[model samples]
Target: MEAVPLEHILLLGAVLFSLGILAVISKRHAVVVLMGIELIFNAANLNLVAFSRYDPSLLQGQMFSLFVIVVAAAEAAVALAIVLRVYQYFKTANLNEIVSPENK
Candidate 1:
């Protein structure tokens, strides 16, 4: 397979990162925020893989990317679980209405 240019991957990452940032800022839902966080993580992973492809001396970045994926998976699982719990307790998932006692 022909290798893609690093600059292309960087540009893609930049675009994804910007979109993720926008999503996080514009969305009021917790799930949407989580999706944005996932997008940001993927953007970072794309950059890592791009660097690993260009630098043949080490595979550390690629390995780190793998770890990041695993961690992201775990994070998503835990975050979803929390969201479910909150929904069950509150009967709503609106970010504005969900507040802790300390905040109230």
Candidate 2:
């Protein structure tokens, strides 16, 4: 059995994080932004798991990653609820329109 290098894992994580940042920046819809956030979370998880694998003596990275996943799940739930309400009230999921003063 062979192990993957930490640099490779970190590079993958960096790519995922960059894509997530791009999506969050360029997308106007709330749902797309949420998906971007999930990407970012997954990237973080990947890094944590990679680090934990290298340091088997302590599983703190994995434990923190688990907590991060839990928090991301809860954040998604609450954010989606807010997006839903905003859609119902404003009739659009575009973040720009939702926050626009003209919408009110």
Candidate 3:
């Protein structure tokens, strides 16, 4: 069986990263932005895992990717908690309208 090319994995990661960026830029909802951030995190994880597959000696990349996934999960939980609080206070999830007093 022929192995998958590393370049293909890298290209996929790049596409995911670009889509994440576009989502963050074009979406007005906070949760959507959070999802975009998660996409970027997963893209990076995919890159790491791909590299680990290509390099037998560098098993650390796979471990690091696991840690990154854990951290991203924690971050997503905290971010969602914060978003809920914001929604409770503002009654809307639109990012452009979320102007705190500190921003004034």
Candidate 4:
């Protein structure tokens, strides 16, 4: 069986990254933005694993991706907690509408 080409993996990662960027830019909700951030992180992880596949002796890419996964999990938890608080106070998750009291 022929192994997948690195260029294809890189292209896929690039597409994922671009989609994540678009979602972050176009979405208004905080949770959606967070999801976009996760997508970006996943894209990076995919590229890392793909590059590391060529050199199995060095597991740096896999290790780094694991670290990123842990960090991303922590980030998602904290971000959701903050979003929950914002929602409780503002009664809405729309970032554009969640202005400060001073601004209102």
Candidate 5:
């Protein structure tokens, strides 16, 4: 019957975003980086939904969140395809290995 506080939701989102940033920075695998990017997108979506819940006049935040979800899905598909191609060409999924000039 009671609603959760907006600050809690925002804090959760911030934590997710920070974790995503850390993953992207610390991981060497392309797939892990993509997952981190997805985490960042989900964090933004969480913030959008939380704000939308507080404002009843319009559902723009929810609509935009839907759009973002769609875009993130498409982006994931394309990025995975690219990663697959890179793996096929380079025989590895490690970002550093793929980019190293010695490999070329």
Candidate 6:
């Protein structure tokens, strides 16, 4: 068995990041946007792990990834709470609809 090349791992991470960006740009629902954000976070974690694999002793990359995970969890909670509040007031989760004539 052979180890996968670093380039290959990086490429996967890039693909994930790109998809995340596409989702964030194209999606309208708040939950979908949150999912896309999670995807981006995972891609970053993939990158951190890959780089840390090369420097096993320091583990800084892995540590930072953990910190990112913690931050992401907090972000998700806060963002979801905000989304719920918005939905409660506006009665719709569609971002476009939320910003329509009545708002203007």
Best by TM-score: 4
Which 10-residue window of candidate 1 scores lowest in summed lDDT? Answer: 92-101
The CA-based lDDT of model 6 is what? 0.93
Error of 2 at 93 (Å): 0.2
Candidate 2, which segments miss by more than 4 Å at Cα?
99-104
lDDT of 5: 0.94
- Show where candidate 4 strays beyond 4 Å: none
lDDT of each: 0.92, 0.93, 0.93, 0.98, 0.94, 0.93
Off by over 4 Å in 3: 101-104
User: Tens digit of lDDT per residue, candidate 4, span 16-85?
Assistant: 9999999999999999999999999999999999999999999999999999999999999999999999
lDDT of 2: 0.93
Model 3 Cα lDDT, one tens digit per residue, 1-104: 99989899999999999999999999999999999999999899999999888689779889999999999999999999999999999889999998887885
Top lDDT: which candidate number?
4
Question: What are the models' TM-scores?
Answer: 0.90, 0.91, 0.92, 0.97, 0.94, 0.91
User: Candidate 3 versus the native: TM-score?
Assistant: 0.92
In angstroms, how far off is 44's CA in candidate 1?
A: 0.3
Candidate 6, which ten residues in sequence have the lowest lDDT sum?
95-104
Which has the higher lDDT value, candidate number 1 or candidate number 6?
6
lDDT of each residue in 1-104, candidate 5, tens digit only = 99999999999999999999999999999999999999999999999999998788999999999999999999999999999999888899998876656756
For residue 62, what is the lDDT in candidate 6? 90
For candidate 5, give the lDDT of residue 73.
Answer: 94
lDDT of 2 by residue, 23-45 (tens): 99999999999999999999999
Candidate 6 vs. true structure, TM-score: 0.91
The predicted structure with the larger lDDT, 1 or 2, is 2
Estimate the TM-score for candidate 1: 0.90
Model 4 lDDT on a 0 to 1 scale:
0.98
Position 59, candidate 4: lDDT: 100
